[model samples]
Structure formats: C-alpha cells, structure tokens
Target: MYGVDACPNTEEPPDLPALGTLLVDTSRNNRVGEFRGGAGCYWSLRPMGGGTEWEVEPRHVRLALPIEQLRARTARANARSRGDIL
Candidate 1:
C-alpha cells in the first residue's frame, strides 16, 4: 500500500500509519486502505480468523523535494494563514 489507513467499522476512515508500524488490529475482520494519489480509500473485509491472511505492502512511495522549495512552501502557507504575504 502506498498511503494506507484504517477504517473502524463504527466510525469514519483514518489516516495512514507511519514507517515501521502495524496499522491493523488482528482482532478485527475488516478494514480500509487509503492510497496517496487516489481519489479516496478502499474497503477490505475478510472472514474472521485462521483462514487466509493477506500480506501488506512493505514499502510506500515517497517524493523528493528540494529543501529550499519545501521551506518556501511552508513559509508561504504560514504567512497566508496569518494574513501576511512577502
């Protein structure tokens, strides 16, 4: 999964997990998956326990941005939030 998230059966969908973390609870039978570039997340449900397990993707796509550009964007957004532009 590129950008993955969880969906609790009773509540709204959630954001993805950070690096080296297990996002799903083994106790649940169903959940959701979210992609970074997609329009929205997806749903995945399975029979409860001890039948078959799907392997999760180990790697995700990460973009490379110039430090200057990133800083510039953050500065612009912060300034815009404060009603200042320079």
Candidate 2:
C-alpha cells in the first residue's frame, strides 16, 4: 500500500518571500517583480509595470535591492501616468 513515507522528499523547500514583496529574477535578466505566490516548485511573479505573471525557480530569485525596488516602483508609476496600466 502507498503511504506518505513511501516517497518522502528529502530536500527542504525554499523559503518564500511575503506576498507583494519585490524580488529579482536573475534567470530572466534580473527582471524586478512582486512575489505573487508559489506554483508547485516554482514561484509566480508579477511585473512591476503590471503585466502578465511569470513563474521561476526559487533558486533563481532573490529579494530586490533597494535601488531595484525604487526603479520598479517608478516604472509602474510612469506606466500608470501614461494609462498603460490601471
């Protein structure tokens, strides 16, 4: 009979950032995005300028630096001003 202990995962899961926290995806040219949630083994990120979300491995993600965060916020604001995003 199959049981929970039959196929236990040995590796610890990656720690997830708080929702809405800014993060940088190194695998995606250091794109800055907000942490939306996790999708199985990957994490979902939403662009700061408000676009479709993308998923990335947790190992490839890191907390956005202060400057990066500022830039993302500014870009979002600009997009909003131009009516590119609501």
Give the winner by TM-score.
Answer: 2
Candidate 1 C-alpha lDDT tens digits along 7-49: 2233443554443322332334322222222223432322121
In model 2, the clashing pairs are none
lDDT of each: 0.34, 0.88
Instruction: Name the regions of candidate 2 deviating beyond 4 angstroms.
Output: 1-10
**Residue-pair clashes per candidate, as listed?**
0, 0
**Predicted structure 2: clash tally:** 0
* lDDT, candidate 2, 1-86, per-residue tens: 54743423336658888999999999999999999998667789999999999998888889999999999999999999999963
